[model samples]
Target: MMGNVDIFEMMANRYDTPERIQISKATADAIRKYLVDTHDKNAIDFGCGTGLVGMNLLNDFNSMLFLDPSQKMIEQIKQKIDDFNIRNADTLCFDFEKESRTNLQADYIFMAQVLLHINDVELVLSRLYDILNVGGHLLIVDFNKNDEIVSDKVHNGFDQNNLTELMTKIGYREIQSKTFYFGSKLFMNHDASLFILDSRR
Candidate 1:
């Protein structure tokens, strides 16, 4: 995971390129579809990189917590918060793999393009489950199953049904997932599609 952390840290300053920002906006827009009745809840953008996706959703939640393992990414988010004069947004540089589940409680937690970087998907998902309040929701936007991309450090993608089943075993309910977008060179520089999974705690 050091490689993943180092990669993100090095890319923090230049993470918001035009293409990346466009993709982030599209992902954020897709995520917003399932956010009904969430305006009054607190949110955590787990594995948030530079707050690009979460920042697009600040007004949708009462408070936004940008949680990531990369300190440099958190610093970029800090700078964004300061520049925008955002009062309800905060940042935390926390790694779920290295650290136990944190006391951080949120009514909603969303991870965009983040699961692939995780070494242990089940452990991290279960830990995030523990961090959520009852009746809260977890939203994940990740690439759909892809066979072309292969890597030792990251997952190629995920199968929605299998992911839903995994979440069910972890005690999540009302699980629903669907592919929402397709893009060129999206996953590991291979053309890929993205899916959004909504699960309740």
Candidate 2:
């Protein structure tokens, strides 16, 4: 829908503020609980910005892929990887919505605060569903829909029940979701709540 590459590219350098790090830490903690054992599993943090969530959860997987359309954002993740001496992570600058990208299969796929930015939600969800290995899991963390937050480019947020129904339509099974965190000014400077949805392929 909206081209977020330019906006994210400009924010790449200063993206990791204390507030963001705290939020990522909370997200990582929630995800960690669902990971039974990830020593041999491969994970992808789709739309990962600066490796905040993926980096924090790196130890749970054998390999982690950071994908985003903004080169500057990828650059920031690379820098963090280097600074932290992280060896199990890789970066790819690809936009699944606009580009024909391939050869990416993961045991786990994590998306945090990303679904709202896309123009076509179902198409992107279908693409992501196709990229997972059989029996793999998809974890989506995003805001619950808010009528107060309005934007022409973004979807305000999503309703958990509606999102679950969409995932079901896309062929996901054993889907489970819950709201795990709440924050003030979390979305467009308005108070919003965050939820995590887990679905099996």
lDDT to native, each model: 0.91, 0.91
Model 1 off-target regions past 4 Å? 1-3
My TM-score estimates for the predictions, one after another, are 0.97, 0.97
Error of 2 at 127 (Å): 0.8
lDDT of 1 by residue, 1-201 (tens): 423999888989988999889989998998889898887899999999999899999999999999999999999999999998999999998999886766789999999989988988999999999999999999999999888887888888999999999999999999999898888877778999999999999
lDDT of 1 at 168: 96
TM-score of 1: 0.97
Clashing residue pairs for model 2: none
Total backbone clashes of candidate 2, pairs 3 or more residues apart or in separate chains: 0
For candidate 1, give the lDDT.
Answer: 0.91
On residues 1-201, what C-alpha lDDT tens digit does candidate 2 reach at each position? 575778899999999999999999999999888897788999999999888999888988999999998999999998888998999999999998886555789999999998988888888888998899999999999999999987887899899999999999999998899999999988899999999999999
